[model samples]
Target chain A: MHGKRVGQWNGERTYLLCVHCHNPHSPRFKPIKPLPPPQRPSEMKR
Target chain B: MSQDPPCTGACSGETAPDPSRRTVVQFLAAGAAVASTGCSLESFFRKSFRELSPAQVRRYIAELEGRYGRKYGKTVTVGTAGPMEGVKFGYGLDLSRCVGCRRCVYACAEENNQSRKNPQIHWIRVLEMDKARGVDVNHSDIYYDAAEVPRPGHFYMPVQCQQCDDPPCVKTCPVGATWKEKDGIVAIDYDWCIGCRCCMAACPTEPGTSTGPSRTSPPPK
Candidate 1:
């Protein structure tokens, strides 16, 4: 559904997702991260 | 790190899964089904962003309903609004000029009216990150140790809730305990809180404190 909380605990990564710009829910119904930059194949195949 | 395992359904995979494929085939079938309905699914169980066409979104949502099934179809928690509403709090910290002082953390304790037996829980915290190559990743919570200010060479980053436009904690709250307000601040209904901790996990704020009651912490001077 919604992107899992922005910073989820990836035990392997050993870092927490800081809640700087995210709330668990929103009043305005905004997506946490802006919709991905319009996808470009050049960017995709780095 | 290598991403976690694929979610295996409406959470990922937009193309027809190859039945002939041997390696990721098992996950692909489930993914194809989800993609058919169209929803954002991460390559891993993560809940990553996926662009879904309208038909895909409708289908994905329906499938999610099916997967979670009857568990979510009915009310599992409290819905009655409490007097806790009409209350709001906001936190701001300017990282570009922070000095790694813990005074704000303590000040938050006194200002927010927190319990004194332990550390006063403030929604704000200052962290130190190494400016050296690849060292920002090793940042530490200075509050865990409560040290002196202006630790020589490290860069200071004081973090507080950005009061995000969208909040994941409120969405996943099974009890509807948390809600973002018109002011962009997210307030929790303490009376209705089920303490499921879903909100804490959903918050992206640093040291996203979970103690009962809350307050806005002052910034470092």
Candidate 2:
């Protein structure tokens, strides 16, 4: 399923296989710095 | 008779109120309201993706491309590609092979054109699980910061949209904004979405869907 075409109905777009997004060597997602939580309305300066 | 009592300001004496003037003022007020909300009148009234005709779809796409190009200072193409016939997409992953590196998470984000800042959105989540506890989700940790992956006695599991055969998210959507395509991909109509987040709660694989905050400021010129 890696290199197969999705057919004419979809303008022959190639199906994105697993390897398209993932590296064979390390399939898991990398750790990321989490975004800060949204500030409360009460915390805003007047 | 005595110059109509000196023509009080509250009363229009010998002059009919102009309907055209009233209409213009009303239109100005409506235009201001729409502008202050930061949504164009056309976009506010645009039909859902499924409801749009081919001509309407093309017109909308062109409008979107223009809007996005101006915002990002680059030409942007928004494709409205439909599902292919006889195609049903499925995904499989080998738990033994996954090392929890999280490359897929960022890749998915970049591919989907999700927001990069203010509120970073990730569709995929990798959870670090202890081998001793097996597949217990309660014992898993998504915030694992190991110096290297495969954390000795731990394993990693990545979760994403299952694209379920019978999606509860679609069923729970009050506005019918989300649906499963013929090719098994679950799609959302952003313009039609009410931001109720019913789909988020209906998802069996918790947090499979997330909502982004509305843009509160104009894009930088």
**TM-score per candidate, in order?**
0.42, 0.55
Task: Give per-residue CA lDDT, model 1, range B1-221, as digits (tens).
Answer: 12233445654657644434533665686588678867645533334445656566556566566666566776333333433555454655556445565566656666766543322355566666665632353555443332444444566676666676788887989988788887567777775676677777876664445646433334434
Q: List the residue pairs that clash in candidate 2.
A: A28-B102, A29-B101, A29-B102, A29-B103, A30-B101, A30-B102, A30-B103
Chain A TM-score for each candidate, in the given order? Answer: 0.17, 0.37
Give the clash count for each candidate: 16, 7
Report lDDT (Cα) of residue B199, candidate 2: 93
In order of the candidates, what TM-score does chain B achieve? 0.49, 0.63
Worst 10 residues of 2 chain B by lDDT: B1-10
Q: What local lDDT score does residue B102 receive in model 2, on the 0 to 100 scale? A: 81
**Model 2 per-residue lDDT at B165:** 89
Judging by lDDT against the true structure, name the best candidate.
2
Q: How far is candidate 2 from the true structure (C-alpha RMSD, Å)?
A: 12.0
Per-candidate RMSD, Å: 22.5, 12.0
Q: For model 1 chain B, where is the 10-residue window of minimal lDDT?
A: B75-84
Candidate 1 achieves a global lDDT of 0.54
